[model samples]
Target: MSIKEKIMSDLKDAMKAKKTDELRVLRSLKAKILEKEISERKGGEASISDEQVIEVLMKAAKQRKESIDQFEQGGRDDLVDNEKQELAIIESYLPEMMDDDEIRSEVQKQIEQMGASSMADMGKVMGVMMSKLKGKAEGGDVSRIVKEELSK
Candidate 1:
């Protein structure tokens, strides 16, 4: 099944199981997906693909992580715990992220493949790297590794 279908199926399961937290997150995700679909339709585009669903999921996860960090920094343990739970729910659908070592290796491979040398080629290297790494890794981590590799 597609990501959106899987999410919808899981939403029903969560509802049946009386999983309040999971249900809340799933509902929010569905709403976001619908919003994106409507926006795309306005732009004269067709329905969204699984890749677009993943993009929405990633954005939601990023927002939750930021909320968690801010709550922790402000000494709001109560809010932090809530945000962490939501973040966990949001991440359940995401692919596993690459570790630093894995990301660095991939960056190095791209740099060689693209024949990119020095900081001047950073943008070209980054474009290829991000498209390849997409949902498997965070952009910040990929960019950092690319910059470090290019500097070498």
Candidate 2:
């Protein structure tokens, strides 16, 4: 099933399971998606492509990550826990995450392939990495690791 369809299915399951938090997050996600699609359709019959949908999902996950960090920093454990649960639900729409070893190896390969010798070559490395990792890895995380590797 498509990601949109999967979200609807999961939403039903969450409702059935009496998972209020999960249901809330899923409903918000569906709203965002439908909003985008409606906006996209304003000009014609164009609907959001799967890639755009993934971008929406990534944006949601990133926002939740920021919220989690801020909640932790501010000593709001309750908010942090809520953000964690929301993030978990958001991530269910994304593909499996890449671990450190995989990210490092992929960054290395991209750096070498792009002949990125120093921080000056950072943009090129990022271009390759972003295209390869896309929704699976956070861009900030990739950039930090690439900078560390190049500085070595």
Whole-model alpha-carbon lDDT for candidate 2 = 0.88
Q: Model 1: per-residue lDDT, tens digit, 3-86?
A: 899999999999999999899999999999999999889657668898889899999999998898899899999999999899
- Predicted model with the maximum TM-score: 1
Per-candidate RMSD, Å: 1.6, 1.7
Could you tell me how far off, in angstroms, the CA of residue 54 lies in candidate 2 after the best superposition?
2.0
Residue-level lDDT of model 2, residues 1-152, one tens digit each, is 88888998999999999999889999999999988888888667766777778888989999999998998999999999999989888888888888777899999988887778999988888888899898778888898899998998
Q: How does each model score on lDDT?
A: 0.91, 0.88
Which TM-score value belongs to model 2? 0.89
**Residue 125, candidate 1: C-alpha displacement in angstroms:** 0.8
Candidate 2 residues lying further than 4 Å off, grouped into runs, are none
Candidate 1 segments exceeding 4 Å error: 42-45
